[model samples]
Target: MRVRNRKGAPEMMAANTQYVVENPEAFKGKWAEKFGNDHPIHIEVGSGKGAFITGMAERHPDINYIAIDMQLTVLSYALDKVLEMNLSNVQLLHVDGSSLTNYFADGEVALVYLNFSDPWPKTRHEKRRLTYKDFLKTYETILVPHGKVHFKTDNRGLFEYSLASMSQYGMTLQQVWLDLHADTDFAGKNVMTEYEAKFSSKGQVIYRVEAQF
Candidate 1:
């Protein structure tokens, strides 16, 4: 998502430093301390505009959520939603998903979410996919033992690639949904992201999976 820079967006995010952690690396393994509780930490890697992360934080008060995204413009928009909700269990991190280890210690995270990520479909760009082996390794290092990655996407190719990649990496596939929105039970419990809702309304098939590593 190429988010055009919005005027004063950076300034707005700067003013809300508490919700937007500008120096997340400083917290590192102290994320529990940052949240003022030892609650389980669950993070969304490309948490665009913060819908899923903030919604999860509101729904699950026992879990702390960190929204990680590289785009400042998107982070700014996400910061607004968090503030509007007065959500205390959420924080925004302006960083790339590749830098997960720099901000989290080994076995520090309980769950990781990858929602509507860029597929990087070209064969040559395979490594850029979030479910690529290298990225999975990073998730393994940061997540607790047997920690799970819950992923959702509307692209069939990406879903197939992710399932194959996770299986090749020796991760256990606990659940797989070929058409997530078609299942009434799962759809009701799912926190739909902006992209997911948009695509689903157009009758696109959404795929979801839970893989434990």
Candidate 2:
């Protein structure tokens, strides 16, 4: 993950969202039961500040969402958005994404969203990268047949690695685009995460792809 020199964000972000879960054990199973996690779940791993997940949840009411992020400050903002919107489909969690098995059952999720995931630019930190092969296998277990992982990143190396990892896992690349922002619809549809806003503003081209599970 590339650490920004700017550690904090706007005051609106903190005021925009609130922290919903402090612990995962008591809430995970019950929430899953309430929403029937087995029913077409789409998750956003490391959903920063919640704009994308909230927008997605609002758009797709039929599919349930379980958005996970490790940062309390960030998750707080996301939870508040869901609560403020009175959206029933979106669920927020503060947990280590690498420990996904603890919450989701086999063939539970329908899709995994990797929006601008940590680049882990250094070679030594490849394992820490979310799109690593180990993480793909974990996703495979949770997703049903034809389930997919929708990945979008501005980092070229991570995009290449993710594509290779997905292929190595026998997952098909259903669609891919090197310059997602070049597409008018994708660019106009601004689901404003702090990082997404910053990266795009700097004129970085976004890379996106969907891998079938």
Candidate 3:
């Protein structure tokens, strides 16, 4: 999805400085200190437009959430939602996923959410996929021992590739749902992202999985 450049997006993003972390690298090892609690931290990679992460933070106030995205335009939209909701447990970061380890310490993250990430649907671009082994290694480095990754996607090719990639990286997979909306167990429990709601409404099946390392 190509995002149209929002005029004055950088200024808008800067104005919401309270919700967006200015120096995430400075809080690398002491994330809990920033949150003023010892609650477990959950991070969502590519948290475009903030629907899922904000909803999760609102639902699970006991857990801390950091929503990361690389684009300022998209991230500003997410930050706006968080501010509108007056959510204290959620923070937004305009950072690339490849440099995630720089903003988090080893064993600092409890759970990771990868919701509807780019498929990068090409043989040569496999390495760019978030679920690729290299990115999985990065996740493992920042994740606590036994930390789990909750992933959802409407793209069949990406979901299938992710399952195989995670398995190859020695992650124990569980709670596999090939058709998430049709699953009674997740009814009313699943928080849909903007992309997710759009895709599922059109009769596309959503695939989800939990992988623990």
lDDT of each: 0.94, 0.77, 0.93
Candidate 3 lDDT over 1-213, as tens digits, reads: 657888988888788777789899999999898899999999999999999999999999999999999888888889778988999998889889899999999999999999999999999999999999999999999999989999999999999999999999999998789999998877879999999999999999999999999
lDDT of 2 by residue, 90-166 (tens): 77776899998887777767889999888888999998888888998888887877788988888898999889988
lDDT for 119 in candidate 2 is 86
RMSD, every candidate, angstroms? 0.6, 4.2, 0.9
Worst 10 residues of 1 by lDDT: 180-189
Q: Model 2 Cα displacement at 20 (Å)? A: 3.3
Worst 10 residues of 3 by lDDT: 11-20
On lDDT, the stronger of 2 and 3 is: 3
What's the ranking of the predictions by lDDT, best on top? 1, 3, 2
- Segments of candidate 1 deviating more than 4 angstroms: none
Q: Residue 118 of model 2: what lDDT?
A: 82
Q: What is the alpha-carbon lDDT of model 2 when measured against the actual structure?
A: 0.77
Give the number of the best model, judged by TM-score.
1
Against the hidden reference, what TM-scores do the models get? 0.99, 0.83, 0.98
* Candidate 3 clashing pairs, residues 3+ apart or interchain: none
Q: Candidate 2 has what TM-score?
A: 0.83
